[model samples]
Target: MNIKEKYEMSKKEYEKWGLDVDKILEELSRVKISIHCWQGDDVTGFEKTQNALSGGIAATGNYPGKARNGEELRKDLDKALSLIPGKHKVNLHAIYAETDGEVVERDQLKPEHFKKWVDWAKKNGLGLDFNPTIFSHPKAADGLTLSSPNKEIRDFWIRHCMASRSIGEYFGRELGQTCLTNIWIPDGYKDVPSDRMGPRKRLKESLDEIFSQKIDKKYNLDCVESKVFGLGAEAYTVGSSEFYISYAARNNIMSLMDTGHYHPTEVVSDKLSAMLLFNDKVALHVSRPVRWDSDHVILFDDEIKELSKEIVRNNALGRVIIGLDFFDASINRIAAWTIGSRNMIKSLLSAMLTPNDKLKELQDTGNFTERLALMEEFKTYPMGDIWNYYCEKNNVPVAEKWLDNVKDYERTELSKRS
Candidate 1:
């Protein structure tokens, strides 16, 4: 039978278990996943530089057809968004600003620099998110930014972050929605440091100075991200997870958790409930990490399913800001975006389609054996039928047909990049 007929059959099966398939689809339609812009250019922003990547971050691989400029990057983003089904937003780094053939220092950046991006987002009917580019600059060559012992360096980064917040406010004010401005500095030592406390203290003061001016939260929400370690900062990272979580809780700001930012054994799914308990809202940088902080493209894997289940089970979708954060220059950039994005949406849909209420009831009534059995039985549900129907409803290609579109685009557009 067709997808609709199969979905109808699956819908009836779910109905018998006290689940509403249509309601789940409706909820999934409303979710807006923010796609990162850096994926198109392998984290290489529009800046005049000839140095290796700094800030404890590196983009591996040299796949051809990387976006050469802002126009091409936006064009690539447009193509990727067309294939994805739901409403979405674009996440931009400060370095992506369009400077009219003139050099603009990070500290001197103004909202006018990003006026083109705001206009583009408005035209495309997408929301905008912002981030301060603290790495890949001459000042960051020493692998320290906000936490630098050099007063000049610390002040420069502080001013840049503060300016970024203003730009974020501008995006929100112009677009009629709050913009999330996230701060993640790659400031740590490659070798063991005897003065870890000193650097952290400096970082705290710098953050306080950057946030001294209180912008309205409605226009711009501030978020701080923490990492366990970075390439050179493996021995010591000033902005550790513990520091940011405490700082965010104390300052009433949002804490962002990058899935690849922690130890391999630690998962963000288990941390969501704790974050929701303390903070009014939280943010996520969803990416796949293999062994280390290798920002591989996302897949519909076990951790992703569990992460989505946590969000659905707690009903915390409204409180969580979901955004993609990976750059794989080894494959077609547009395909990387589409595949990772679709898989993210698929995982969420799977979670929404689950009979969580029934399973919770089974557990609440102390029926452990039945709960395990029902959970396993849910693995066999006809999720593909519902997913295909969702794609059809959203006017996107269903099943594996999207691969054809990507291949055609590569042949006509991406192949011509060189």
Candidate 2:
């Protein structure tokens, strides 16, 4: 038996106990999720995002090209605002300044640009999802490891942090909500060991400095999704699992779990512990995992097929804020992202609707023996209901009756568990 069989058995037991299957389906289906527009390649233009019929867009991108010429990016932003068809619009990325190597250019920052963004947010009622990447003059070739040893490099990084905080403060004052100044550092070790402990120390220091400037209000650092990787497994120094968690815990920062960041074969239990321990600090980066490759695939297949159920288990469900991490460099960026988002919502709905109270109960108890037993029972069970929910949610109506048959079968098998 495997997980599917166990779930089926549990679903049957739940139905017998009078669980409202439709309500469960509706609750799961109604869960709110949002994704960044940058995840897809075809997301370069504005028209593709402004959805009038469905939900408004969640976008994060480099300021429109006009901003570079000392021209206003906010005007383009205003134009984009007019394009959105819904009441809620979100900007998921922001960069205050650009820094590369030893050179830093702070003089070009027109405080007016900040004002423009805030004004736009007020008028359009948009939520900003800010990022602290590529905000300085010296471009990070190796990425912001936050552990650099050089004083120049360290100061450069700190400047970007300050700029991000300034923008957050402004947004907080105006919008009554602080922008989530999210960070995803590419800083890691490669090949040789270098003495950079002092510079590495600046990571927390910079963050603290920015946080301290807040005036009688609150803001969210939305835990940084750290990863440790290099071109050829030379040895990553930053964003590795251990370092990220430890640093986050020590610095009073939250943890946002990106499924693609973990070792592909990590056990579901371990993933649960990581999310639960950091539950209050948790935010999910919704994407599929394949062989340590964070390919932002359309998540309906083997990639995220079963793992999503594991996520909702162990009480890590409600804290989820889904997003697409698919890079634009992949396939038809637009179509892939649109389909991926649709599939992701469908997947969550399917998992949300599963009537496996027993399996959920077994998961909560933390008893290894029972867990193994449930896993065994899940092996041969046909979870056609799960498939049907997924299909129906995605508008494939033909699977409705097929799903009913599967649910009946599951209920029958579940009776044996008691």
Give the TM-score (vs. native) of candidate 2. Answer: 0.64
Residues 325-370, candidate 2: write the lDDT tens digits: 6543433233343456556655554455444576667678877687
Which 10 consecutive positions of candidate 1 have the poorest summed lDDT? 47-56
Question: Per-residue alpha-carbon lDDT of model 1 for 173-249, expressed as tens digits?
Answer: 99987999999999999999999899999999999998897798889999999999999898999999999998888
Task: Quickly count the clashes in candidate 2.
Answer: 29
Task: Report lDDT (CA) for all predictions.
Answer: 0.91, 0.48
CA RMSD per model (angstroms): 1.1, 12.4
Per TM-score, the best of the predicted structures is 1
lDDT of 1 at 345: 96
